[model samples]
Target: MGDILVDRQEMKKKVEKFKANGPSEPLDNIELKNPFPVMLKEDMMKMADAHKQQHHNFVQKLKSRSNERLEIPLKQNSKIDSNFDELANMSLDSDDFKKVSGCYHINIDAKLHEELCSKFYLKKSPPMSVTKYLERVNRLLCPSTASLLTAAYFLFNTVFNLKPSNMTCVVPLEAPPEDEGEIQMSPVNSRNIFRLILGCLRLSLKLIEDKNYKQRYYCKVVGMQNMPEMLRLELAEMFMLDSHLFINQYVLTRFIFQFKVFDHNVRLLFASMK
Candidate 1:
């Protein structure tokens, strides 16, 4: 009996030892051939660069498709006045540029404007530029309209992958003055409406082409308390929240901005028709 008890105690000890070091069942039949090693620094950098390139390419494709569907048509329409294209060009060197100087900060030049507009409708003769027109138009549009356009333009230019920019504590100019945390705009002249609208259009194409412009510029409008109610609402609708829907936000926003800016001016030119 003493021997049997001793043997039983030895057997219990062996079982406990086995339980302590028992192999866990393999996960989903994935037997480890070799354990995953820590990633090297070089390998990690390569992975990061690869991810950034892939992200840029994906955004380019998205912006391209949108541009094709929307801006391309207006560009092709023969009925639209060809002079507007020239006017776009003239704004660069002509005294007319001075008329809209209030809207354009000194940083943007006439040459840059020409470069921006020509991307959509590769025009010859005086070289029509969108950037120049935007500078002028923003000044011409109502103050409220200009404010909205400028804000929209900056937003369109800077965002990565249909994502809104990580805009921080520069309180939007539109915020209530009574609010303790609000930010205010400095005393400056220039219409934001045309800027925003044209900026959206320019950005849409730039994003598609993956050009240097989109890479360099990315500033949203700060304060926009005086934006026209109708224009503001329309622009907000155009800036899309979802990528899965029917139309591309970039293309749609550009079109809406252009129409809103030009439709009135064109109407005035032919106001007699009414």
Candidate 2:
């Protein structure tokens, strides 16, 4: 009973003090903490460079197709690609890449792009560089950016066959390409580059977008009189890929980076030839 009375008295005292002083409020203005560690501008710049190097190293390790080597299973709770081409090993992992229906980041390796440029140059005859051909193609097709990027992506994979095969043959095959259902693609070159681009661009547009140009539209746009040849090329490309033309953002970004490098190198090669 004495202890309870003492507690009541203390509470009464606090109340009285509050009434007298109109309630004491704590101040939050005082700066009592130590200064936070801060980097100099130069140090920050060096740190940024270090971060970039670390990122580069991480991407460098992603080269091989071995899931064990990468330690990142290509299909991490992802769907198996619909490609029927036995030779195609590329997987954008669009399902896993888009974890929980959200897209994520990806990086490309320098060596892969180097291979892209090397393969592009490897096939062509002298004087007919990739730049000249690409320019001719751009002028001829007047393709949209999405289709162009997709076509470039396809071209990269077709050349390397390192990713999902992007082999789009504009030329109709006379002989049976394979003994079984295996895909057989001819190399890209000056002779068929136009047809290849036409097929790839048209197919890419169809695959990537909702509304697409018709066969007659492509013929009119490309100034081609023969709709049959154009249709054949498109069908041939579709067959070559076994109708597996899906491209996700991850694949698209990687190829965009690679295509930039390819375009730059092609222009440089063209400049040097002059």
Candidate 3:
């Protein structure tokens, strides 16, 4: 019995020795912790492919939506014909006219006839009259141009107290020639061309100051008509000199003049009154 007990003790010691030698080896199939590899390579590949596809799609969408614009021609299927009504209801002829006329015309630097002829293509034939030129201007140019011409007429009459008369716009048949040294720097005066639009604007402002000017056509008469006959002849002469410069300095520059020519103090005063 003592021998049997000694054998059993020896077997227990062997078992402890085996355990202390090293960790137990895993089975081929029943792995202890998936030692085959914890790699997520497939998942990583899928994520990479997804990113590439998204980038490609974004580039395609951008290319498809670039620079898509459309332009429509004027005088097409459009219909809005109330020009007269529009003019009647405009604020352009309101207070602005008064501001302009009060400034330049007070001095005789009123470039009226040149202002008219610039708008119309006139014949320089021997007997060119304001009435004849006006007839052509009325028939050829827009109402706005006509209005400007008429405004110039009144501007001349009121400031210098002139009347309209038939006169050749050209210098008389045998007038003395300008001196070689004396240069004539005339104001711009094309109807179609606007020189010193600011000057014109100044004229307009002065013409509209009367309350009853618009009601009984007084504005037309006092502002556009009623020019002294001598001034009318002078205007005719002015229009005859040049047309292109007249447009540039007058019509195109008209808006610019409003800001450039008027005094800052006057603008502030106007603003305060408003």
Candidate 4:
């Protein structure tokens, strides 16, 4: 029993020494199998060749189309000279100018000439009253509150540098009367005027805000406090209608100009009263 125990201790020591030293022989029998499949070199070359052939064909097609496009203009140019004689014989009359007063006048009849002149040369009717215009604009715009039209007008004028001459006080008729001698009234419609004013206001606001435009001059116009009480109330109402208008400094600046114009008119009215 003592000799058997001594043999077991010797065997344990040998196992410990083998573990400490690691394996002495090479692991030739442990074959390593790759988890991923390897692509053959010839197959890779074949794929590259196919891709190149497709690319070459695409390039050839592009060149052929480009050549055809270039040749089209050249083919069309040859036919242009042949049509010149036909074009020369055609008379080009001015749609706007009915009569050309030259050495020989156009052979149009006197009645026809008079009709053309009346149709083209008649002046448009004058714009409606301010109150009526505002009422119409409010109806069309459907503003959150009243007096937005008044605010829009002053803001538009200041921002866009509007002039009396440029202002379309009257709206043009959509269709002319069938009778040549009938009088046409071109009273300004609220819809047309409001659309124009709104468009200009939106465009100007966008430009001023986006480009960081200097608005100190316009700001002064809006900041005036000497406006009439009625006008001030209207402006306050406009602000209440859309708080978002105050978000942009440019829009806010324009908004203030409403008071300036009203203040000027009020001053004039008081002076006239005196």
- lDDT per residue for candidate 1 within 1-274, as digits (tens), equals 3432345566567657656866477544543323222344468889988976775565455445535743332233222233232344554645554332212111122344334333322122223244665555344432333234333544433221132221211111121224233222221113333333443544334334333422213222212233353234334323422221122333344435544665688788799777
Candidate 4 runs further than 4 Å off: 1-122, 145-250
Q: What is candidate 2's lDDT per residue for 82-114, written digit by digit as tens?
A: 221211332445333222222111112334433
Candidate 1 residue-wise lDDT at 54: 78
lDDT of 4 by residue, 30-133 (tens): 32232112344467888888976775565455335433632211122222233332333345453212121111112223344333223211133326544664
Q: Sort the candidates on lDDT, descending order.
A: 2, 1, 4, 3
Output the number of the TM-score-best candidate.
2
Of the two candidates 1 and 2, the one with more favorable lDDT, higher being better, is: 2
lDDT, model 4, position 273: 100
RMSD of 3: 29.3
Better of 1 and 3 by TM-score: 1
Q: Provide TM-scores for the models.
A: 0.19, 0.39, 0.18, 0.21
Candidate 3 residue lDDT tens string, 38-153:
34546778888897677556534432332121111112211211222233334654553323222221212235533543443323322444465555534433234324543554
Query: lDDT of all the models against the reference?
Result: 0.37, 0.49, 0.34, 0.36
Worst ten in a row by lDDT for model 1: 166-175
Q: What is the C-alpha RMSD of each candidate to the true structure, in Å?
A: 23.2, 19.4, 29.3, 33.1
Q: Model 4: which residue pairs collide?
A: 171-188, 222-256, 222-257
